[model samples]
Target: MKSKVKPLPAEQKEEIATSEPLPAYASEEGIDPELLETARVRLELLYGEVAADWPGFIARPGQYQMMQAALLTFLSAKAPEDADRSGRQLAQLEAGTGTGKTVAYCLAAIVASEILKKPVVVSTATVALQEQLFQKDLPRLAKIIPDLRFDILKGRARYVCQSRLEGVINDVAQDMLPGDMFQDAFIDTRRQQEVIPRDRGQAMRWFKSTEKKLNNGSWDGDVDSLAQTPDPQDWRQVQANAHACNGGRCEFFKSCAFFKARRQAAGATLQVANHALILATLQNESTLIDAGNTLFVFDEAHHLPSIAAEQFSYRARIGTSSKLLTSLRTVALRHGKTLPASTRPDPVAFAQLITGCTDKLSVLERFWIDAGLVSAEKDVHRFTQGEIPQDLIPECEELANLLGSVNRTVERIAEALMEQDESLSVSERDEQTRAGVELGVYVSRLGTLEKLMRSWATHDKIPWAKWLEWVEDAGGTNIDAWLCASPMTAAQVLSKNLWKTVSAAVCTSATLTACGSFDFFDRMSGMNRFPERRSLVVDSPFDYATQGELRIAPMKHSPKNSEFSGELCLKLPGLLLAHEHGQLVLFTSRKQMQACHAALPAALEKQVLMQGVLSRVELLKEHSRRVKQGERSIIFGLQSFGEGIDLPGELCEHVVIDKLPFTPPNSPVEEALSEWLGTQGRDPFLELSVPRTGMKLAQWAGRGVRTVTDRAVITICDTRLISMRYGQALLDGMPPFPVVRPRA
Candidate 1:
């Protein structure tokens, strides 16, 4: 197959390769008034056409207003030559669910991009939403607009690297077994990967099948295009890694799956990708696509801060270190044996260096576990404040010093593998190229270990929280521990890296405000840092007070009381029988959800569908199965089911919340965030904890009234909502629902 669009011209390609200046762009104030008005009129027509094309499309004022706002924001940044240069054209919008936010943003963004001569980049928080835009929304827009071109882009790992595919295929031809190789395992300490497979044959078959599928055009080399989810172990081995890529130099470069997709993305007018991929590609300043001069729409935009923090975070795992050392030995011998006598690296010297690093890491790992700093939980141990206790600072300091020497040796060895030699043939270079890829893995690992030890040795490091968490598998004595450090807040990182660069951006969600203010989101997103920005809150068209009622069921004991579990267990059986249609019972913890399930009678248990017993898909399917066939179905779910779940109409009619959702006090990330806030002379509980709980409560309640016609009753078993003073604020902050508290 051939590409329909021509590749970018050489000069255009060069611009994409280079980084642009980040100095503030031309202001919207200088733009011609007539031009802005003209753009607005055209966008209005496009939105109207979308509404007219769809049957029974009852236009809501909120949806229409959101579209206009998006158009204005995009146009506000259009100062011709210097436009998109502080990229301050930003808006924090709170468009409620069912407001048709997808169409509003998509239609407005596409039209504005065309007028401004820039690509439109729409990022979703989840793959499901990404697919909806790529397959459903974009295709619909393309039909109406004719020339509108869009493509879906994902992280590199989501694609099968053709180079890796060819290597595995050739390995089979040589009768090589995969049980030994890791497909050039790219060790990323920040993200955990599955262990290697036991059977080489299974991996060989998967690669061959995938290659065949791509050739026949049955699959697009996209992991999502597969009929079934591939096993994590097999998928991790074959997935593409940027660190392992040789770019245009690889033997399989012409047919590379990842780059092929990147090329396609560069040609499109609008590129839809998940948040993680967009963040990474932009930060790396890669030439894969034109990132700047694009309008970015972050749907489910609330998750941006935390996800960005994860990207900047570093980690060092115990077992991964062992694997690193093992690979070091394996690669040294394999490459040394192939090279000519004069150019070969010394295998004995490299072996000793690898052994020394391994032994030193083992000693450090033992010291962390044995020290009293770690607090054991269900399966893991966490350091409370990310602090390496007072007594262990000396040991940690020594580890940091030792790691510096190890890092230097690893860098030297990796470089030696890629060094050009006069005696080397083309074939030797190919072997050297492969060896260099393996060397990159250890070199990356050594860097992470060094950073972890350096941070751990420091005391009273605010914002930068350092800790070690060790997890022991059930019934397995050998445990895996990780040394981790992360910023408590992603504000600084986002404001500097992302917000400063894009031409214009719209950060939006169904719930972005708390207690009738955008202050929480503004501070969290670092949008407050920008001098000129706007915020909007579009109330849901649904009349929450008329459509739903929140009933506070009085309990004899508070949720934290010793007898509360038994009391909840006793109260649920009768309450379960009272609700008709489908019921979604939300819980704060899995243990409580299970405990309440155990208290139910066998008949009620038979009627209930639990989250853990089946796949979330199967659980919903079974619940639907029971509900439609004239049987009652109730879904018992935890935090995951609280938000981003839709069971509209009769699928879900009643919502039962057992207790208020709050972050665990000792959780590493939250604790660090709290500590950081205190140092800044701010009340951590009010700023961080309260807003989070309110958002979650709003999410739980939002589940009940998905549409204007939706009518349901929400019962809160905990009496704290009305009893405690702070709880009243949470209740007041929730969407306006009529209260039915008899006596508190």
Candidate 2:
């Protein structure tokens, strides 16, 4: 196979080559022509108003083109009544930085949702972007359309649970009975140990202050909304969680903070969420949003595949799980004693079930140890092609059945404890509620182990990666073995779950294409399965030829050489000193960043700020403060600082990338994916690494030029940009910056 290097698209095309004509049903029936015409008129009016009246608005052709393309793709969607019809209602939109992509998609999705009579759900990959949409972009659009309403819905763990908070404030300050075995068992079974504040007086005061704020409506019960960041351990004790939630049965359900937000989300025209929450809803973990009747706009859509894969994977520990079962059994017996005779769970029967599970688990652990599957020398043992030893299947099946039975018995015990008993004292009621929540947590853990065991017991058509990892203590001593399994790819999963059922969707990102094509994203995101899916790439309006230049620093060693860090340190100082303002030095690895930082001169080191020393937000703030004070500042960061950092004008006048971000197949899932691809006679490096590296390079280079008048320079320390054959392909994926090469 030959390498094909496609140059960056210079302008937007009228029609995407891959987009097919709308299906006959969408064109001839089930759509109201009057409604579409009204929507089009409203969209045009809004765009015109923004162009004329909005402050700091630039007249960019790319934004308009993107808006038109997005609107058309959405208009081609099949209505809810025609969901089973043969039509794909997805638009793969890639808008470059500074293209106003968020506003473009929001307007399009909102209008289409009105016409289709479905709610719009926009999912982002990061909280910052989600905040920008809800707090910044949508508010501006809402002014244009007065009726526009949107709400942000995060995971349940973000809010405070009033019930838990009251219990913590009331009970934690008092003494407990001395010889209470049930109490000891509940404490042991908890995943998070109780946190004892160092200053109990100050802690109690803070808790009272927070409770008062919740009562006075000054605080919304969201940790993020707090003026001061609460201690994470303290927050975990009172945070809203699935295990602790009794839903409508709770005394505070009417005013529950998480439920209040969910109720608002149900009524809002648009709901903003993150990728993990959306995938969690698909997995039936929670029902926060209705996927079937919702139109979605996924921003930063490139992250969907990895997030989906992680959401579906399962893991369990052998030793820890055995101990947890024993503790759960004890808690179950104690709680059974508290319930009435008629409603009480059968403690003897439940104990027998748990004992069977523990017995099978012990046998499995012995099999792993005796069969030499896990040892001190090896930390990870992955099954080839996801196939485990034939002898282990029967044991897995037996354990799965026993665990399932035990899991059901635990659920029954939890429900029995949930029943309200009028005769119980206040302390007894509190203990019962707390015990039920712990049992709920155990039920969840047992369900996870059962799923992993079932996956091991039976084979599926889709490929999976099964592995055993030896868990070690901080002193490097082996403590337990972990069983893990994950699918090779999430493309098929997304296609079956989302694309086939969703009413309509648009996946947009700044760096979706690799090597000037959407083939990689299409395959990885499961969009390729829908041949009728439309795609459009809108170039940034900024004139990169004048605004920025790319310089390939001359190097004597390749990035793979041991001396490359030395080479990078030598080249970066002059570049940093010349800018004398905001400078970002991105490294692919922490080891390299440390090496380069240590080698810098004393004066330069004083001016440098490295990641992990301060939080990302504070680091950026400190750098900005120095730059605003007319002082030189250089930031040393890794992959996390590559894409989301926004420093325009004098804040960031130069960006120095140590080398290409080439991530090889290191994890079990990636290795299994590469192995599967290789068996089909494909080159994993070209298909996976190159394209992914291309996207990273594009994102890194984009940080250089943010606004129209802002000028900056991007310097690449690695020689591969000009020395390797595939380097040109990576270059073609980046902005059309003027290239400066070293003289021969």
Candidate 3:
């Protein structure tokens, strides 16, 4: 009997056929078959060269096929016009983690850009990946393909402003007074004093020494590396006194590291950058480096929408006004300037503005507090009716009026400062000017509150309440709150910005589809409506059935009870002891992680590594060393440890999750989102939470199996996996394995 290969799924076959097609222009030109074959041979030879140079690295089967598909899609889009007239096309490819996806994508992008006479923009989610591409992959590729061009573009904050550094040094030398009295008051506190010393001369000396070592030239312009910690006072001085950067106008523009890097990017065939900068470019229509003829490659593309939301979200706090007041006072006191008591700009007026805003915010907060109280007083069964107390309307109206008044006052002050004459001395005028700019920014943010108030009053989606609270900060306790209306979906806000406007886009990630369906990711990303768009889900080539085992431990009680963490802590030590170390125990909540850390036996505690207390790299290194030394150890981490962590062989033999990590429905933001989705007649449970949790569970499970030869056991202790209907979705998302029920 002959061995038989399994047939490809209908969907997979369609994806392969549709992903590529012969370029129309190439066909019109009647390109010779020999020439096309020669080009293909050259591409293979280039990849072979890379493999020969890197002794252990080899391209997996079908990797080239994926690359060809990516290239053909890109080239087809560019066939109609000159590079200048072609609109960029988006194509998503789903290649699993061990598929050498990065190299395949990079190779395809390079070839497509060259063939079509265009550039390629590659964007990724994390800096670690950015580093991997720039430091490891790109350089290796460049060595093999000598003509390839590439450059890395980081956000503006990554680079140090030469003028700003000089200004900070000068300000420290002059013993400049503190910018904010509130900050001055905290100077005596242990945290503040220890982090930022009082000796101005010493601080300046330290900065100068560090600056010299850097030679005032580093790509990305980040100042963090030069100092042990960021100093707010130093940053303020730098912002106020630094020379204006005119891009190409500066005398130092030629040797200027940032500009030099940008120039290099302009000439490169491929450019790598972060999501924020890329989105900002698209929103503003200003490509950092002319991408007129470029195909954008978005890596870890699932994060694009969330990152875009964060970029567009507005935030404001009570101390913004207080800080402005303090800065204004410092300038006035130094200039010996006194204005007429009635109409003159006084620092107290600014403070009063903040006080009035806080008072108004307090009213809104009280309304919510009373609402919570009323809900508590209602019959338990009546809670489902979703009625708002009629008494809260007047308070909401009054608070909205107060916020409006505060916004106007700030805007008026900003106008006066902007209209002021420029004849004043640098010290006399600069601080006030900056303060005015900041006030304008806040005035715009206050609009969010106004919008929230309107939505709440009208009950746009669902009945919800807005609230605020005074929270402690390093300066002092300050107010921050949600201008929240009942739960709203991020999809509602993101759909217009991300989904509708783009002519074409490709979203690729290792974990996008859940339970063999892309519906979950599509809904969350606001891409569900594009049913005609192409998608693919390629499985990891690693054989997980051989490399890993799934074990579900039986539990006697629910995980929701208060004593669950303690119980888990008690149960974990024996498991760790049996496994003989190299264990990673993940928890959904910080409180649980802390309780487990505290409850572990002293000997076990000594061998356990916990998150929050140490950096990720440090924790991983310590775990690796302990496992190498043959000591049993457990590493406890939260969501940060879920994905992107790779540990093969004995370094990881057991993976344990405390429970399913679901977004807490009570969280103000999530609650608002859920309520909004409910109003839209969508199943919030299946559409919003289940898929998100399922994706996370899959990511966490992936940490266990990294290589074909690796083997480990995964234990999900939560009883819900067996009891809940949605548990099947989570289980189906995982690699296929035989189920085993442990003896109670």
* Candidate 2 lDDT tens digits, 476-539: 6437788888877788878877777677788889998998889999888788888767787886
Each candidate: what lDDT? 0.72, 0.79, 0.60
Which residue window of length 10 is worst by lDDT in model 1? 172-181
Local lDDT at 81 for model 1: 52
Which residue pairs in candidate 1 have backbone atoms (N, alpha carbon, C) closer than 3 angstroms, thus clashing?
A: 24-86, 25-85, 25-86
Model 2's alpha-carbon lDDT is: 0.79
Ranked by lDDT, the better of candidates 2 and 3 is: 2
Per-residue lDDT tens digits for candidate 1, residues 1-744, read 322221234464344224255212213454467877777667766766666565445676677667766776777653335534443478877898788888888877887887788888899988888998898877887776778889988888899877656666775212211232333222332245455544778877877888889778788788988998887766765678765566677777777778888888888988888888777776667655454577889999888887887766766666666566666567556655655566555677667666766776676667766663344454334454666566556655766666676566555554566565558788777666655554555555566666666767775545477666654544755466666777677777788777776777888888787655677777877787876676777657788878889988778999889898889999887877887668899998889999999989998888888898899998998888888887879999998998988888777888999998877656566677887677779999889877888888988888898887888888889888888877877886688889998573
RMSD of each: 8.0, 6.4, 8.2
Return the top candidate by TM-score: 2
What are the models' TM-scores? 0.84, 0.89, 0.73
Per-residue C-alpha lDDT of model 3 across residues 1-744, encoded as one tens digit per residue: 322222234465456445446332112122244544544555555566665664466555545555655554454443323332222243456666677777777876676566557677788886668767877788878886889888887755455555446546655222323345333322213234344445787667766864575474442344434436456555444431112343443334565555666777778887888777776665545646444345767789877766765554432333343353344335433322322234345456545655655565566556544454322233111112133445555655664565676566556565555444457676545444444443444454455555445544555434433333233445645432223343234454445554444323456777777765777766666665544345555556777767777877766656877666667878877767778858888888898888878877898889888997789899899989988998876789999898888887787888988888887676445555666567778887887688888878888887777766777888888878777898888888876655555676
Q: What would you estimate as the lDDT of candidate 1?
A: 0.72
Q: State the displacement of the C-alpha of residue 228, model 3, in Å, after optimal TM-score superposition.
A: 4.8
* Per-residue lDDT value at 566 in model 1: 88
Candidate 2 accuracy as TM-score: 0.89
